[model samples]
Target: MSNDNDIRHGRHCVFLMHVHLVFVTKYRREVFTKEILDDLRPMLASVCRDFEAELVEFDGEDDHVHLLVNYPPKVSVSNLVNSLKGVSSRMIRKKNYPSIRKKLWGGALWSPSYFAGSCGGAPIAVIRQYIEQQQTPH
Candidate 1:
């Protein structure tokens, strides 16, 4: 249901790639507070901006965060995730929140693994039907 305007333009291609990402805290500790989540929003947004991507949506519970990012094809998902985790962890640790520090004894804010899924487009069945309807060249 997206319009042409929803597509992004690049020097060599047009794209509309979005990924839903989830990052959990190390050991799934319930360390996040409202104030901490508020601070994290801008930090994550800044990291997205660095890769020429947009963080379309972001939210989290006490132990994890979710981000919907619209990124260009040139950027790899793993790389983006790494930067997001690294920067946010370093910055948050720098803040020295007593509650978070005490819970995260291992020194890493996020767990080593994360979830990434492609989103924001027509269903695969619809696309498949469209492809099947294409006329063949004689």
Candidate 2:
């Protein structure tokens, strides 16, 4: 079990951080099947581990995937995203070249851009309540 603080005792400092990542398929094509999604989870988890980060959660539909990752401050989010995308792209291509090639057409598995956001801050309940109480135009 981990704490909200995610405080890691490194030689120089302690830090805790998380990020939500989204990767879309090239041309927004629907290429992922149930078997592919299943294969992707572990592949992504392995990538995260290689980066010294943790894959908190991984799920998505046919054209994209959402990954919740806990990473240290030393790692840049963009770099992580690039590595994740690059490695997975190659691996998936090698494994499922025929199907992926047919769908993507450009030999690219993922689009150039991705979405990444920091996670783990204020409690979810508190944030939900704050949102729920917001006054909106009727």
- Please give the clash total of every predicted structure, in order: 0, 0
- Identify the runs in model 1 with alpha carbons over 4 angstroms from their true place: 1-5
**Candidate 1 local Cα displacement, residue 5, angstroms:** 6.4
TM-score of 1: 0.94
Best by lDDT, which number?
1
TM-score of each: 0.94, 0.81
Estimate, for each residue in 83-113, the C-alpha lDDT of model 2 and write its tens digit: 8998888888889655677877756899999
**What digit string (tens of lDDT, one per residue) describes model 1 on residues 1-138?**
144238888999989999999999999999999999999999999999999988888999999999999999999999999999999999999999987989988669999999999987899999999999999899
Q: Per-model C-alpha lDDT, please? A: 0.93, 0.85
| True-vs-predicted CA distance for residue 113, candidate 2, Å | 0.3
Which stretch of 10 consecutive residues in model 1 shows the poorest summed lDDT?
A: 1-10
